[model samples]
Target: MQGKRVVVTGGTTGIGRAIVRSLASQGARVVTLGRDENALKDALDAMADLPGEVHGIAADLATREGVERLFAEADVRLGGVDALVSNAALGAEPIDEMADDDWRYVVEVNLVAAMAATRAALARLGKGGQIVIVGSISAEIHAPGESVYSATKAGLQGFAETLRKEVEERGLRVALVEPGTTGSDMQEASDDEQREEIAKARMLRAEDVAEAVDFILSRPPRVDVVTLRLEPRLQELP
Candidate 1:
């Protein structure tokens, strides 16, 4: 893990932040990207004492322009990235209720942004480089009303599968880590029924997902842990 350079999108908060901290603690140089300037600053400040190098960049990831700016800065500062944890996603409204503006924003942020970031990182990633997409179980099973979010996550799952084949020859590894009910802010926007279902889980935490990432990345250079679907369930698979 010494001196590995990692890029984590959505790193100002939630699972993304946890991934940044874990990587930084493992002696990996980490660059965390988010749009919130204040939150980015807080993320940087919090990571200052880490043993590895830590930096933060604020860029709106929902647009092509924003992704371009992010990678340009990253090139100037990091030479190239060895790992990318693409976690930036917009969880949005029900299909019938979605405004056109909101629908566009959600798809652009949740799917396209991650693709652009992946393209940038893969451009320079050498052998042993890794990509982890922080996906959702929503990709596998859609709920009643989360059409936009579910569609984007399902798209991510498809993208990851194709990506693994495209990059494997170059020794680049890709994995989509789909987690069910992570203990994060995604549910704060949920209505009572949704929130109640999430609360019942013995739900997965951000760090739990981070550890799954750690496990994947820690594999030997020849090992690739692909398509991880982790859910916290002792009660039923029954």
Candidate 2:
């Protein structure tokens, strides 16, 4: 990963933050984005001592304009893009219970933003460039009370699969990492409860997902890891 220029979205907290640290620790120049300025600053400060360059941008990904600005900044920061990690997502209440604007915003940030980011990245990425989408196992399990969130993740599954076929011949690799019951800010459980679940092996840590991403990107150019499903050892299916 040395000298690789990468972009990670929604990287101020949770899984995305872990991915940024993992990549930077391995000597990859990383530029990450999040909507919260303070969180972005904190994340950048925390990663200041990593082996590689780590930069943060505060940009909302819920709109095309924001995504465009993010890529524009990345162009200036990294000069070129070697990899793109679409990891930003928003949780939502059940479709029937959520306000129209709220649900639409979830769809925008979780699904539409990812597609937009991917499209923007494709324009800059060349051979051996990689695209990794951080998805969720909720898509497959269809857990109750997660209709909106599940729908977005399921959409990502389709996007990643079809995109891989379309880009493979160009030497670009696309992969999806679906994690189950991860302990992150998106989780409804409290931090203490999440810690307990993690200790009991009923929940996965954000770093676990980060490792999966690193593993995918570290592979030889000839190998394309299409899909990786990572779940807690004892996570129950709905």
Q: Which candidate has the highest TM-score of all? A: 2
lDDT of 2 by residue, 47-150 (tens): 99999999877888988778988889889989999999999999999999989999999999999999999999999999899999999998899999999999
TM-score of each: 0.91, 0.98
- TM-score between candidate 2 and the true structure: 0.98
Residue 135, model 2: Cα distance from true site in angstroms: 0.8
Model 1 compared with the native: what TM-score?
0.91
Give RMSD to native, each candidate.
3.0, 0.7
* Residue 77 CA displacement from its true place in model 2, Å: 1.1
| Residue-by-residue lDDT tens digits, candidate 1, 50-146 | 9988887788898787877777766776778888889988778897798899898889999999999999888879888999998888887787678
Model 2 residue pairs with clashes: none
Runs with alpha carbons beyond 4 Å of true place in candidate 1:
189-201, 234-238
Worst 10 residues of 2 by lDDT: 56-65
